[model samples]
Target chain A: MTDFKNLDISTAKECLLKKEFSSLELTEFFIDRIKKSNLNCFITNTFENAIEMAKESDKKISRNREIRDLEGIPIGMKDLFCTKGVRTTAGSKILENFVPFYESTVSNNLISDGAVILGKTNMDEFAMGSANTTSFFGNVINPLKSSEENTKDLVPGGSSGGSASSVAANLCMAATGSDTGGSIRQPASFCGLVGLKPTYGRCSRFGMIAFASSLDQAGPITKTVKDAALMLQSMSSYDEKDSTSSRKPIPQYLDFLNFDIRGKKIGLPTEYKVEGLNSDIVKVWDDTINLFKKNGAEIVNISLPHTSFALPTYYIIAPAEASANLARYDGVKYGFRENSDDLEDMYELTRAKGFGDEVKRRLMIGTYVLSAGYYDAYYLKALKVRQLISDDFKSAFEKCDVILTPTTPNVAFPIGEKQNDPIEMYLNDVLTVPASLAGLPAISVTAGKNSNNLPIGMQVIGRPFDEISILAAGKLIEEYRSFL
Target chain B: MSIDNKTVRKVSKLAKIRINEQEEKKLIEELNNILGWVDELKKVDTEKIEPMLSVFNESMVMRRDEVFSETSDELVLKNAPESKSGFFVVPKVVE
Candidate 1:
């Protein structure tokens, strides 16, 4: 049996095609890994369901299959994406028993492409927290060790922590992740993998549990950049299901994987050189720049002067949107509906008990900001600042093809470190929130390991529908660093 | 400025989240800290600047305003804490 731990999508495809392994065997291997690891990576494993899907894939493969792009690949899905019949809790008690009747577009697309659903992975409650600790199920442990002998446990960053952790641990080959602000990239960075947050509307959002709808775009978290690209190719398509899905023609992301970046103008935003940035992070970022230079990519200093407002602006806008979107779950819809003597008590009791502390905090902040008295003062003001932030990125893109920054200010902190400080937790997305506001594509690829051997990632951001150039630049950094 | 206890209770009611006396005391302190930091936005010269509502600048798209749309899915609505045949069952706002 091939070591499922070491297999990437390319090798798996080759092995399956050569009859070295059946898709059933591959699916079983990862399913077995999930069973043994007990890493809190999965909240729900459709083992029987996956085995049945694998059997069908085996039949197609044996029939000299009309090779689906992601044919026979097993992918772990973040629980936030709704899967019909299977429980999708969004890692919140409010959705604990909720099984969606319809499949999310991303999940449906994966099913159509012959990707086996390995399981539903864990996440922060309603995809709210940066640290995985907010999960109702439990925190997912970082797969990488502090050292071979010392397994000093750290949090696999979240709210897509389970997706990243499972991929890093080889629980599944590649997984689907949603990035609202820095969800995918932060977790991927922590777990040492490639996480892509596509240009807003690049992937259909239909049936994906809402969390800041305008900002949430589903993308793949994978072991290799090529695997991520291939997954994106299969996952991204214009869907009538999602009204906001971009009508822009899909580009062959993998076709440009080997493209030359000889004359590429990479923009480095000076505003990211703010105070409190870890010196070690800066070192890795500087090294990544040097590697780009060695590969003939020119680097240019760019300014996104309004970047300082991104965090506050995001807090206001995302919560404002989330507050509105999440209102659907007000004890009057599917999921946990508490029974009380009176109707008012039922509405008050259900939500109060269903949502966790962080979700409640966000809801309160959202409601407070969007209330009639506060809308103009809080939400509107933040929206204007958001525009300024987007404008800053747009103007910078005019100067360069892609902008680069540290994906997270520091490497993943210990699990409980930031749990109590909401502001500190919110600040974790400082380097990432700006891109989301602009509806641009951004990714975090592992640049290098820190002193503790935890991975540090640097982000490459591109203009709308310019995912190719971002991936190209990412691959360049990956290839260039492989030599060093 | 420190948020008063009564204001904290009022905001809590506005937010639809219940806070006990002890929790309210804690929330009051936390809200003050957050408000102090958020006060920085007031420093910006947004005097003549227009406030942004949404990202896309689309004006009202005309459609058939008289068209009837389903208020709620029966199965979904039935899952609520309290629901009538085709509507959400909520407390009577007025007699």
Candidate 2:
């Protein structure tokens, strides 16, 4: 068997250009693996489409044409991204047969860069749960298993669990993931992959199935830090279609990896070392910083005073936005519809059957929080706390160039471990949510493995539009054996 | 604030999703636990901080008022589960 496991974008591009192997060969290698994969990481497989795409890519390569950024690469498209004429479910039964006429801006960019789409990866329905368990399709189990712990089946952390698993398990070259609240980073951490959630407004959310409009941003889940930089360079853009997307120039994120990290100040937010955090993660995090210090980087202690409030604030704000976004799925214009004589009955029954439990729970919470009388106490107050949390990141940035913390509180646990309790499941986002609430760029760099053999990740957060510095810092961790 | 059965029923109606007795029972316990956990937000004294209405707080972009799309009705009604001519045919709003 060829070592396609470590075949990253940079290497694959070289081999293609050097005629070591054709894009068709590489695409077939992955398509074969995906067919054999029992991870349940994909909702809609596009193998036939992929074969056509790979053929088209070979023409471009043989003509010695101006090679595009992601020329001939086979990548996973998270089901959240709408690929025109392809089944885009967003991991919900409602949109099971939903074939979009238009493509999402981010996915369109990747295709334009000459990438072949292998499949639409599964996710938590409407990107709601921290575990992949909530998908209407089925639970996406983590490819990683710890025999020492004797766990039967572990969950790939979500809502980009499929993307993470597909990439980490080498089912695809890399994948695109959308992060509303650590969807990209958390899953990547669990699967020992590098996931980057670009600063909000970095990528337009024009056709991404919206979970939370304000916080949802598109990014990459890849096998390596450099691969993440390459994918993001193709992903980020400004569009008039998305009002929140930044008009700021999309920097060559690939150039970020070349920058030196010596003498850069990395902030360690004390609040992240909270109660009941995994001892294994804490050890890896401390060792990662010490490695940085040895490499001539300065470590600074910073405080995100409102860090404690981020999760509560996220649960409130995200659900409130989701309630409004999901209102469009009423069985009328598109999606699964339950036909009833009464119009309102149709709406009620369609939604009752269309959405899974996690989604409904969020919708109800959103309805309650934004309902009459409760608005001030729940939704309005959450907004105020959101501002405070944003300010905390701003102040911390002032003290240091970037922030460093553990990507998740703990490593991957069994699939059913936290599913019964919503609060426990939501706790998985605690360390990652603060950065999301503030709309900053954060990457989960996979550090060394634990005693139980699960991967640990260290996150490096940067200033607004400062993806370069954070990528530079993340590259250092990638160099250290701690991350290898 | 903790939600009870009455509130769940009201909110479920507002959300246009039906909640049967079994689901209602599970929702009450789950939602109460979640909301109870979320009550930790009250600990923060948000005194005079303005509610954040936007991320990055950038001013909205203004575009010239012109029809940029000439999308056909066929395209618009392409995905409709039920359609008559160019219009999406939902359950009748008025008898």
| Residue range B6-82, candidate 1, lDDT tens digits | 77667666655666788777666666666556556655556666665544332333444586643338646644555
Query: TM-score, each model?
Result: 0.94, 0.98
Clashes of each: 0, 0
Question: CA shift at A159, candidate 2, in angstroms?
Answer: 0.3
The candidate scoring highest on DockQ is 2
- The regions of model 2 sitting more than 4 angstroms off are A1-3, A482-484
Using alpha carbons, what is the TM-score of model 1?
0.94
Q: Candidate 2: deviation at residue A48, Å?
A: 1.8
Which predicted model would earn the best lDDT?
2
CA error at residue A420 for candidate 1, angstroms: 2.4
lDDT (tens digit, per residue) of candidate 2 on A256-333: 857877888989999999877999888888889898899898999999989989999999999999999999999998
Query: What CAPRI grade goes to candidate 2?
Result: high
Per-residue error for A176 in candidate 2, Å, reads 0.5
